[model samples]
Target: MKIAFVSYEYPPDNAIGGIATYVQQAAHLLAQRGHTVEVFTASPTRTGCEAFPGLKVHRIQPLNRTSFPQEILATFAQRHHVVNFDVIEGPDCGAEGREIRQQFPDLPFVLKLHTPSYMLAAISHIPMTRLAQARFFLGSLRRGKWPQSSPAYHYRADPEYQHALHADVLSGPSQAILHQVQTDWQLNPANFINVPLPYIPPAISLDIPLDTSTQRVTFIGRLEIRKGILDLMRAIPLVLQQYPAAKFRFVGPAWPSPQANLNMQEYLSQKLRRYAASLEFVGAVPLDRIPEYLAQTDICVFPSIWENFPLVCLESMAAGRGVVGSHAGGMAEMLDGGNAGLLIPPKQPKPLAEALLQLLQDPDRRQQLGGIARERVLTEYSLENIGQRQEASYQAAITRHQLKFTNSPSIHA
Candidate 1:
């Protein structure tokens, strides 16, 4: 199978988020399994091709300054002239999937769901700008016949929804995400498939057990308000009130947007300055080094306000670390309803602090939960297992596309 992945971010460019990790790991795994894999990504400094056995990384430099969607289409058009891909997949976080599908009508394009704009607008309590409010209002209108330049254009003319409506297949990382999309967009239940994210553990050994004496609680995500970083900061004091030995570590970059007036850096410097000695911000640890950090962490905390499927939680579980994640989006689904680890409400300090203290105070319980978490990851989220599922989804998409185009009854239906 010749698979092509279209993402703006890829390895050696920048690890923007989970999407980069997803593309790199999935493409690598497919290549290792003897499939020809090619990654098309935007690059500022480098252009042309870098090859590694079965995998080829194409860095695309747009000839002109255009919208990201147009840039992706331009790159794809150039690449399509050289090589034909059997299956093309891109993230739903951007317009790449829909744009590609629109340009290459005959090609089989699969839109992999991340977080939809509609869901984000619904979940986020951050006071919206008038433009954002209009966007939501427009989303409530017709699904496909939206104006291009309206203020609500981005929301109403969502590329993810467009891709889902017309693509060969629409897939997401978890059932929870699929359900949310179906409910919010009023789409058919059968239109979406559950193709779980693949987890390839780092080269580092997972034999090291966390030292419980220091009680290290680690949060591995961008320090944004939506990620519950502020809530986690508030929880630290409450946690210290009970478990004095608790030390916190935040391992990622900070994202302070214009709409949200809060400054994480200032908050950390001023409000949480007294506990600065106990809290360490290992700013933006590389993806490869995450296993090293997890090895040192007794408990992994992901107090995100909302998420589709967080790769951090999966990675922590694969590293044999007990996770204390929020009961938002796919956290509870991944944790198996608190069976593997603890789940607390997001944006609440007391519950988060309580969960942290409970896990930190008991070494035996943490070890037990960690064991369960790792076992679950091995059973369900292994690369081989997910690869097989993904292959099946692709084949199904291909068959559906061929049958539908042939003027035959829809095979998927």
Candidate 2:
């Protein structure tokens, strides 16, 4: 099968957060499974891309100034109809879907909801101006409040909705996320599928056991509020109240927003100055070096308030650490209520702190959970498994769509 994935988000330019990770894993796995995969994405990375064997990648200049939107060149590319594909998939069917479908009306446009642009904007740096406009736009669209710009709303509002509605199926990372979106947008539940990523875990060895120390409670992610940096900070005080020996090491950039209202890195630095002796900020540690930090971590704490799925949690557990995270979005699904690792309630530091403390205080339990944590990720969320599932989904989608078209049935959304 030949599959072409369209997205504005791709690594080097901008990672679609966890979406990039999932796609890379999925595409690679599909290629390995005797399928040819091509990706059309914005080339934000300066070096074009390092290249992945068996996958044809095309990078287009961004259209909307925003990374996800396509440029005029992308518009041309979508209309060019130069490629041969048995199946086509995309991160979402928003403007890209609408514009592309204008040229290829019969193309099977699979509208994947990878947390959606609305959610991304909320997590990313939505300028107050955009925020107000977005909230108003989304609110009106949701409540049937027709704004002048109402012609343009979600991927559903794209002109292609009617043509692609039957051919298109909405997919997400987890059933939890699908349900959340169902309730959030009041979409028909029958239209969505809970197709979690069947991604293979990177073949890195985090085989080292914890050294049984509290000096490292690792935080991995772009330093931002969406990841619940503030909640994590608040829990720091609580964590110390129990395990006086505990210390924190924060990895990655401190903010997701390039345009900031308050610079989180500077803010955290100032805040950490109060506990400067106990905390370390190894700002934006290279991905290769993350294992070294995780190897030393007694526990992994993710205070993220929202996530469809967090690769960091998967990565942390893959590194064999007891993960403590908020029960929001896919974090809750990934954590599985500490069956895989701890799932703390969202927006609360108390449970998060307690979970961290529980692991920190008991080396034996931590080791047990940490060991199982890695196993669960490697077994269930492995790249091979995720890829296999994605392949199945694509095949199922193709077969289903082909049959429906052959039947010439009247399609209705």
Candidate 3:
């Protein structure tokens, strides 16, 4: 099958977060399986097609600095006229594929679910400032809609949500995120499907021997309220009180907190000042350096308020490090209901501290959990296993597209 992926984020260039990682891994895996995979991605500086063995990347530059999506649509249309892709897939985060779907209504367009902007706003507890609330109320009045009636007014306004509503097929990496979007959008159960993301284990061995005596806790992700970074910082003090020798490392770019009027690093510095020597803030390292940090880690903690499927957890598990993940989102499932790693409630510093302390005290338990997590990643989240599932999902989407548009004009024409 000839597959085309449209994503704003793609690795080694416009890589931002999990979406880039997912697209790169999935596209490469599909290509390796004998599928002609073409990726349309953004490039701030360069623009052209880069051909790999089985994959082709079309790096698109924004036209007049105004129409990135329009440029994508035009380029895709020209390519489709020649290559005639079997399926086109893209993330539901920014509706990057929305224009493509509009152009080729009969083509199988899969809206892969990532956390939408509205959901991110909610997760971060973005306060409705007085001016913002006033604008919303005024806008509702102008549109002749009651503000109170539309609790999800933001969802309705979001292009990502609208794209999900009309896509040929919707697929997500986690049941938790799928369920949330299904309920929120009032989507038909048959239209939504769960497909886990693919993660290729690092080439170098992640089997570093666990240092039991000293606890090296590492958190890898943007430091934000949504990621429960504040909760993790609070828990650090508690953990340090019990086990003073334990060291905490935060490896990621720092995000500013609107609620606190300070960046996370600043907040951490001010709050956890007493334990300054114990904490390490390694901000914004390259993708290749992550495995190095993971190798040095003993216990990895991800206490996010909510997440889709986090790649960080998968990396930690793959490195044979015991992970303490929050139960508020897909981490619970990723941890296999606490079998592979420790699970804790989100937004609660007490439980997080307790969980961290539990692993810190018991070296055998950490080793045991890490071994189980490694095995789980090898078996479940592997490239081979996830690639097969992705293929099946794409085939299913094509079938569904054909059935739905049986009487419609052929997109090939």
Candidate 4:
């Protein structure tokens, strides 16, 4: 199959996010499977072309604009160099999907919903603000709190791309995402499929052996309130009351926004100073060094309020550490029926801290849960396994579009 993979981020840029990693893996894996893949992505670091595996990465560098991504894709439109494709797939779309359809009427286009543009528009600031406003005015909307509205009809009804895309396939990192997309867009269940974010078990080795000796609980992700950093901070007061030695270690990139990072840092730094000895912020560590940090830890405490299937949860399990995540979002699905790990209520510090304390004080239980999580990840979430599933989805979308086109008399040259 000849696939034109388009994304706003790709490797080396590290883009340092869940979606970037997933796109890189999917494109590379599909390329390895004999697909002639040409990738079109934004080069934040530098503008040019590069190659990885069987794919050629074309970097679309935009002129000075806060929202360079939407600007570049929307402006390029029919002018995009890579026009003809066996399938025109635009994931995480807004301008890309909308504009591609506007200019390329003959091309059969498909869109994948990562998350609703509205939810992002809500929490997102500055640069993303305009894109959000554009999305709302275009007919794409929000449904409720947890589930994002369908991105299907939203794209189809769009003035630019509405009539260009004849078929759509929806995917997110979890069942929760798929269910919401189906309900909001009024899309058939058959039009939606679940393809989880791919997990590449790091070629990491334990530099420091698991000592089975500490009651420290480690949380990996942005140190923001939504990530349950605040909840965990509050839980520390309670955790110390039960187990005096209980400590929480956080390792992730400081928030990407400087102002936001400063605000969060001041709060977390102040809390750390107040505790003086319990709260530890290891700051942002590279993805490769993650296993080394997990090596000394007994449990991973992911108290996030909402996550689109956290990649850190998989990383923790892959490192043979027991995990405790929020009952919300895709964490429950990652835990494999709740038997693989513990799932606690969101925003509630009492249960979250208790779950952490329980795992911390007991070495045997930690070992048990850790073992189960490792086995489950190897069985279900390995990059090799996830890559194949995503490939199948990509092919499925192509097949569905092909069938629809071949049967329709309107599909003409």
Candidate 5:
């Protein structure tokens, strides 16, 4: 099958988040299985074509003010005469799906739902000051118009909801994400598929021995309140109350705005000054070093307020570390309802700290949970298994597309 992936973030050029990693991994795995894979992406700085053994990447430079979906369609139209694809898969959280379906009416297009703006707003609990709230409400009042100048334009004028309405197939990394999108969009459940993220564990030995006596807790994600960074910071002091030797590490890049990194650094310096000796902020570690870091740690904590199957939880599990994740979002499904690892409520420090303390004080329980976590990844969330599942979804989408063509009712008005 000739498959084309339409994502702005592909490897070697831009791998910003979990979606890029998933797309790259899926493309490679499918190529390894003797399928032809092509990626159509946008690169502001550079534009050209690159090739691998079984895969090819085409990068385009769009005009500054032009919409991304329109640019993608124009690029595809110019290239489709030479190379045809059986299926084109792109993220649904944008206007791309609606545009592509409109431009190429007969083309088979599948839109995978990652995190939509509406879903984010629905799950978000971060408080805002009156000034900020006033700004957001005023921006939203514009309605259907994407004012590039407004700070909240992305959240307010998000076109993913419209895209989903026209998508041939709606897929998500987990059932939780799928259900939430379906309920919110009022879509047919039969149109959705539960496709778990594909994970490839690091090749290096993760069997390094660790100090079991001292509790080493790690958190990896954007340093934002929505990621439960504030909650994690608050919980650290509580954990330290019981185990003074407990070490905490906060990893990953900053988010929300350009100055977020500076702001987070300031917060750490001022608020967490007393615990500076025990806390370390290793900002934005490379993806390759993540497994090595997790291998040395005893437990991983992801207390995100909202998520659609985060990559860190699965990576931590694959690294043979017990995870203390939030009870909300897809964490419950990932952790198997506290069976694989400990689960805690989001935006609260008390229960989160308690859960961390419980796992930290008991090495036997941590070891047991870590073992189960690793086994779950191996048995279910592996790259090989997920690749096969994705392939099945593509096939099923093709079948559905053909059936739609054949079963269309006559429309003679």
Candidate 6:
């Protein structure tokens, strides 16, 4: 099958987060499986096509600072005229594929679920801009309700919501996120499917001995409220009180805290000043260096308030590090319901600290969990498994598109 992927983010150029990683790995996997995979992505400085053995990347540059998604639609149309792609997929975050779907209604378009902007804003505690707030206030007065009321009105206006509503099919990495979006958007259950992300395991051997001389607890990802970083900072003092020798490492870029009116790093430093000697803030390392950090870690903790399917957790699990993730989202399923890793409640410092202490004290249990985690990733979330699932989803989308257009009187006319 000839497949086309439309994303604003792709690796080595505009890569930002998990979406880039997912696209890179998935595209390569499909290409390796004899499918003609073409990736339509954005680049700030360069615009051209790069051809690999089985994959082609069409890097698009915006014209006169125009909308990126609109540029993507134009590029996709030019390529489709010649290549005639079998299926085209893109993320729902920016609704990058919405314009393409509108222009090419007969072509199957898969809206891959990433955390949408509205959800991210709420999760990160980001307040609306003054203009938006004023608009909301006026809208509330017209509806005769408080500014805080009418969430549905806000959702309806979101481009991501509208795009999801119109996609040929929707696919997500976790059922947790899929269910939430389906309910919020009032979507058909049959239109959405769950397909876990593909992960390429670290090239290093899994049997490498863990460095257990000093108990090291690592928290990766952006330092913000959504990541439950504040609660982790609160829990650090408790863990230090019991085990003073244990060390903590935060590996990510620092974000400002609106609530504290200061950068998160500064806030955390002032709050946990006494435990400064034990903490290390390794800010924003490149993607290649993560395995080296995980190699030294005895325990990995991700206490996010909500997540779809975090790749960091999977990376930690692949490295044979015992993971402690929050139960508020998909981590519970990723950890096999606490059998492979410990699950704790999100935003609760006490529970997070307790779980850390448990793993710190027990070397045997940590090793056991780590071993199980490695096996789980190898078997369940492998490239072969995920590639097959992705292909199946595309086929389903094509069939759905065909049926919808086939029964339409306008198409017949």
Q: What is the C-alpha lDDT of each candidate?
A: 0.78, 0.68, 0.85, 0.67, 0.77, 0.86
Alpha carbon lDDT at 149, candidate 4: 35
| Global lDDT of model 5 | 0.77
1-413: candidate 4 lDDT, tens digit per residue: 66665667667663656767777777777787778777667765576667767787777665532355455454344324544566666665343455455556555555666666543443333223455556755553353333233332353454323322344455577997667655644456776678887776765732233335667789888776567776787788888888888777888765533233355656666655767687777877777778888887888888877766788898888777878998777898999767878899887989998888888787788778888887787789766777777777777767666677567433212
Give residue 119's lDDT in candidate 1 (0 to 100): 66
Off by over 4 Å in 5: 63-66, 122-126, 129-158, 205-214, 256-262, 409-413
Instruction: Choose 5 or 6, whichever is better by lDDT.
Output: 6
Per-residue lDDT of candidate 5, residues 120-166 (tens digit): 66544445556776776778667855434324434224567656655
The collision pairs in model 1 are: none
RMSD of each: 5.5, 5.9, 4.5, 7.4, 4.9, 4.3
Cα lDDT tens digits for candidate 2, 1-413: 77877666666465646666666667777777778777766764442334567776666655453434335335335434565566667665354455554555455556666666556555554334577678887888999867554233464554333434544566778776778666656566765766677645455545666445655788888888778887787888888877778889888886633335556777776665667677888887655677777777778888777777777787788877878887777877776666878888767888888888888888788878878887888777765666666766677667666666577543332
lDDT agreement of model 6 with the native: 0.86
Candidate 5 displacement at residue 357 in angstroms: 0.4
Off by over 4 Å in 2: 45-52, 63-83, 93-95, 121-167, 210-214, 256-261, 403-413
Write down the TM-score of every candidate: 0.87, 0.81, 0.91, 0.80, 0.87, 0.91
TM-score, candidate number 6: 0.91
Q: Could you give the candidate ranking by TM-score, starting with the highest? A: 6, 3, 5, 1, 2, 4
Q: Considering TM-score, which of the candidate structures 3 and 5 is the better prediction for this target?
A: 3
Task: Go through the candidates in order and give the clash count of each.
Answer: 0, 16, 0, 0, 0, 0
Better of 2 and 3 by TM-score: 3
Cα RMSD (Å) between model 4 and the true structure? 7.4
